[model samples]
Target: MTLVPYQGDALAHTRTWTTLHDEELRRRAVKAAGEKDTATLVSLTLAYLTQKGGSGVLTSPRTVEAYALGTRQFVEYAAANAVNLLRPGRHDAQHYINHMLAAGRKPAGVQLKVAAASCLYRALRWAGATDVDPFRDASVPKDRTPGIVKRPPYSEDDLQDVLEKANTHEKFLLFLIAHAGLRISEALALTWDDLDEQGRRLHVRSGKGRKARVVAMSTSLARAARQYRQQYGPGGPHHLGGRRATPPEHVFRYGSTFTARYHLSKAFQAAGVTFRGFHPGRKYAGTRLIQQIKDFGRVAAHLGHESVDTTRKGYAQLAADDLKGDLAGW
Candidate 1:
């Protein structure tokens, strides 16, 4: 596959690929490497990982994407300054750490930078470099400043106003996201067969990086899905006039009322919800579940979080009474 090219550079850089044989590109990568040693390695490593998957202990797609983006920015800086990346010592890595701090990237961003460099160091070792990995002993600073926090979920009454205003398709999308906790990609990629009416749940056949997960459906959401199916059922040239011409498994379909640039935006507009797209809605529902359901394990599983700790961190909101109880114990 042809990778998209990046603009405004001395080398006219493009994304890294599995077998990119563009002479000028490789020469630019090497030239940038020779000047800004750490930067070049960081860039090349992120590119390699993005193409063939990661090399470090963690294979999570989210982690890989973070490292790729962090390193890409660092390399752009190196290319502009003409620094050689291959010969950098720990001092070079430290310099980068300082630079990120000055740029207000904080610990999480620094962690990604370190991770990108660490991945590159491993690749270089495989390519016959004898130097030590600068990131081996490196760590994110304890005093690192925090980034912007995510917003809390909407309250029940507020959510009702939005839902009440939404049209049929809009309401269906919000129902799936808010009630079911589906990622946007998962909701968009859904097919009809994945839903089992009798079973009362939907299978997220594939998720980020193609991981599979099963999600339960609410009684209300299932009803909405049925209504939408009948309204936009298999018909004309849109599904294409033929025997196998079912409205391809994709759950969301374009509506004449509003060209939904994105499912959530259209839903928000239709529903008259004032806040951001469906994430806050999902957050709201998950938080409500925490208060309404006593079982922690069930809540975590239902939300598809890796652990209960994550569920608490993202969705739990402590009431004044609960906070006072802890203070009383103290």
Candidate 2:
């Protein structure tokens, strides 16, 4: 048998292709190409991402954490049913789906799991592993009953009160999320550099689905943001520089989602207001802004929506005279 040129250079190849440790390389290559062991693939994927973090597409710390968690859950599900992912058959995929449905997991929750599995399979393929991707043919129907319910918008008065009384970071965060309709993660990931004070714009490097967009800033919000910068941002000696919190430099780093949620809840309770979810504030902002601002396209663009139809869908009902004119006609 002819010897391969890199016969003893396996370690070098592994190091070249992946950032995995020496021990990890041995662990990953232990499984044969056609093997269908779910545990091994899941573990290998986790190890691969962990070892090659910042050097691959998996750059975000939160993304790494999320993948780690999602992989653990997938492993637990597979081990309980003795299904291997490396060679997942239709039966294995169906069983996992059934398990998730029976466990009363929300559709969104199951979708996250599906997404994690898909990502892992893609990574495995990229790593030159021979495994069939189960997610390619397995997708939940859109019309199927969702595990989560759509939340309603907040009343104008109640929403305004929440904005009025919210603390520094809370107020700006709420404003950015509500008026700008920003995702919670996007709102949290913002920084001083992302904000354009002179041009009155906020740059979202990567919003949902990794899409980048520049959203216009409201005059009121711009002024508030400037004040926030002067007081808490990376500036003079009072700013605390990088010594604040984990990634303390983030615009919304003053609190976590739980903390922000609690703050909003308390504000609601104090104002005798109730909301189905935090999203209502966003709805309220959009609806009210449309009524006050004639340029629907501008409003849509400022809110980072891809089209004006989406803006109209939520705000059309809040037409200027919808309430007063309808009542008078009655």
Candidate 3:
């Protein structure tokens, strides 16, 4: 029941719809979605959420994927119960949430799906698509996962243990987060060109929520990186041999991001340390730096964080006993 001839045109069932900003097209499509079956609107609305003009912020693909997964799950649930996916009321949303909880879904998983569904509705309502925002003001429960500290940061000894056990790719990756305070995604997106002056300086191009920054490398890291360059530098097997010959290839040139995280977990297992995720590695770098320098601003700058307060609150995991001497005069 498409209001437009989308079935015969290029915008039938693809992201090509994203490029067209015709208000009439949007109005017609959304109007039909409300009156008729919303079967195709699921993908259309999900794809629309990624548009900057639609969702405000051009959401990252990873985030968009999560949104799609949750939205589709909600659509499936609505279909099973004969609930309207496009026009669900607040009670319908609450019922779906309660159903998930009763079915033994974790609190965090429920929250994620709910959040995604909310985003979907938000996108539609923004464009006057449905005038139905069922998730708005919907009751969402707090995550009651049993853990005092969600993910505990690694200690210096813990990092050393993992470093010793890690393979070449894993070792370098661990250094990026544990020593240099880079996000795992940032490290995975690294290219040979990001290193400067023989790895004495590093250009972090994949910073989260901020522009790029250049960080200076320690003597030991620089030396190790230099050695890595000699081993896998230009013309090496992982260098520039693929279809993207013009662009610099990724430093950790794995086939896909699928196997990259597995390497880190394997190292953690061998080192007998719990895999607390890659964020703990950045936490290690921040906490260790804060301990040595005793300055939140310096540590924040080193970690590429925007604020000293963020560094102090989130990353600087200094024990009160260890900081007693440093704080005595202050």
Candidate 4:
């Protein structure tokens, strides 16, 4: 019943548990909980939740992994300090939050860690393992400092430089984010079948919140897709992949999301452009589309936002800048 190190991928652990039969999952949980050890108890409960679809418990793979890591942190903290995690009270939750803050963790990071601990307790309660929820009303500190300074969207000239210097695959990725306004995750999740050659559209099967939509592709992007397909052979379900003859299920096979970002950043560096991650491309696309259409609702729909308010809030700075000229004439 030794607690395993939590360094490996939590998603991999979740996926393994999810593929097991219910009885097997229960057997594994039982084996892990050979004793009444608190760490083992938390691990077994998480395993059970991962196997049972995590409904009200763990939501997505990212969330599952985040919670698992957070729980391990908490469990390690408890073991070190000789605190009883299984029956923790509100004070214990507050202490954990304060401890993370004292360790120089960012306020947002501390909040997420607290949230993960809260979710773990909720899952344990649902599994009938714990009766107390310490994080139910824990007073987590707010990030009162001025919000993070987001890097401004690339200027037209810088964007042009990026487009000119990008290689074939890199160019496609840039176009998807910059011109089409696809989020990095959405762009990476695209497949050859999502492309509509006749209609010149790209279908986003499942976007944020499991919503789906179709977005019109620029003529240049459509032409590039056709050329890319012809040159590399039609990719697998994912629109991008490794240089090998056979494509994988995902777009970038560079291990993880961070690796993909590193490659993109390298391309930007090579182009002599400031690299601010992919979101700036999306912001550039949104700003340009808003100026072109002059319709917030239309812009919202194009960006796959359920509400125009959301779109407006996200682009408030751009909106203000766009209105300056109109206000000057008035």
RMSD of each: 6.8, 7.5, 4.9, 5.4
Decreasing lDDT order of the candidates: 3, 4, 2, 1
The Cα local distance difference test for each model comes to: 0.60, 0.62, 0.69, 0.66
lDDT of 1 by residue, 98-181 (tens): 778888876665777777666665555443443557666666786422111345776787767777776667777777778887
lDDT of 3 by residue, 1-330 (tens): 242323332233334455456685467556644443444555555545645324334444466567767877876787678776566766998898899999988777898999877766766665556677787767767764322145557877888898789766677667777887887767777788887746488988867664688887766567667666665678666455445422455676563445667888999999999887888888878888877878888888888889877777678766669857868989
Report how far residue 14 has shifted in candidate 1, in Å.
15
lDDT for predicted candidate 1 compared with the true structure = 0.60
Q: Native-vs-model 4 lDDT?
A: 0.66
Q: After superposition, how far is residue 145 of candidate 4 from its true place, in Å?
A: 7.8
Off by over 4 Å in 1: 1-32, 35-43, 50-65, 80-83, 142-150, 208-211, 235-247, 253-261, 269-278, 318-330
Q: Which ranges in model 4 have alpha carbons more than 4 Å from their true place?
A: 1-59, 102-107, 141-152, 235-259, 307-310, 319-321, 324-330
Query: Where in model 3 is the C-alpha error above 4 Å?
Result: 1-15, 18-42, 53-58, 98-111, 126-128, 141-148, 197-199, 235-248, 307-313, 326-330
Clashing pairs in 3: none
TM-score of 3: 0.76
RMSD of 1: 6.8
Candidate 1's TM-score reads 0.70
Top candidate on TM-score is: 3
**Model 3, residue 2: C-alpha shift (Å):** 9.4
> What is candidate 2's CA lDDT for residue 124?
69
